[model samples]
Target: MKTILITGATSGIGKATAVAMAKHGHRLIICGRRTAVLDTLKEQLSSITEVFSLTFDVSCLQEVEAAINSLPEHWRTIDVLINNAGNAHGLEPLSEGNTADWDAMMDGNVKGLLYVSKMIIPGMKERTSGHIVNISSVAARQTYAFGVVYCASKKAVDAISEGMRLELTEFGIKVTNIQPGAVETDFSMVRFKGDEERARSVYAGYEALKAEDVAHAISYCVHAPAHVMISDLTIYPSAQSEPRTIYRKQ
Candidate 1:
């Protein structure tokens, strides 16, 4: 079984992917900022496969470096790295946006992914075989009012994924970007800054995608034949055609 390391594995797509991968008997290193949630998830998944948990804020380069460095020698050679830890902070027009929120988005979504990848990539280079899956968003393709930074952040992920693929091709490393639209996770809630009503309304009239759907896709990407690499994929709910066009049953 290949060893997999997933960032932000405490909840949503990350957590679901961890569980799905564990069921396939892969060794897992689940990373998150929440210690309690990490411990709980590790205990739960350990029964299915070898499981280790690391708690660190991916946005913090020092923490990301230290956490990966702290892994045992055996776990350091991760077969797959899932860059899945990210969140949108607030919704407001560009002129009205908060700088703090912008920082959070840039740091968490873009810089954080880079930081983790930087730490794990050398090991993969030495092995000359590994897969990197980056969880992007439909926002990367379509931008809406009040979502400029979030969209930009995801766009950066797309660029990074392609660049990494080109740079790592000689080493036989594969990079895949999964761009998911409107999944009903805590994503909306967090973006609304804890406004549950607002978050609920966003998915009220449509059958939004679920975490498990994305998880299944991720697992599929990881398990594909060695010669086949699904470079980029975009998934949306049946009722949604794009980020701005959702056919809601009103």
Candidate 2:
């Protein structure tokens, strides 16, 4: 069984992926900011396969380094790395956007991904066999109103995944960029800064993708033959035509 490392594993897509991968009998290193939740996840998944948890905020480089460095040497030889830790703090016009929100998005979505990759890539390079799956969003393809910064962050993910693929291909490392459309997760709640009504409204009209749907797609990519690399995948609900186009039955 391959050993995989997943960031933001406490909830949402990350948690669902951890479950999916564990079912495939792969050993897992689940990393996130919540120790309690990580511990609970580890406990739950341990029944399926080997499991470990690392608590750290990906936005902090020091924490990322320390946590990964602390892994037992065995777990360090990660066969797959899933860069799924990211955030969208607020949705507002540029003129009214919060600089702090911009910083959070850039730091976590862009730089946080880089920091974790920096730690894991060297090992993958040495082994000359590994896969990196970056979780991006449809926003990378189309920028909607009041989502400029968030979209920009996801676009950066698109660029980073391409760069990783180009540089790591010769080393036998595969990089896949997964751009998923609207999924019913805590994403909207966080984006709306805990506005329960607003968060619920995002999916009120139409069915949205679930975390398990995206996780299953990721599982498929990672389980492909060694000679095959499913490079980029974008998934949307049947009712959603594009990042901004969703059909709602009134």
The lDDT for every candidate, in the order shown, is: 0.95, 0.97
How does model 1 fare in lDDT?
A: 0.95
- Residue 67 lDDT, candidate 2, scale 0-100: 96
Clashing pairs in 2: none
Off by over 4 Å in 2: none
Residues 1-250, candidate 2, lDDT per residue (tens digit)?
A: 9999999999999999999999999999999999999999999999989998999999999999999999998888999999999999888899999999999999999999999999999999999999999999999999999999999999999999999999999999999999999999999999999999999989988999999999999999999999999999999999999998999989
Write model 1 residue lDDT over 145-232, tens digit each, in one string. 8899999999999999999999998999999999999899999899998999999999999899999999999999999999999999
Cα-based lDDT at residue 98, candidate 2: 100
Model 2 clashing-pair count = 0
Minimal lDDT window, size 10, model 1: 68-77
**Model 1 CA deviation exceeding 4 Å by range:** none
* lDDT of candidate 1 at residue 165, scale 0 to 100: 95
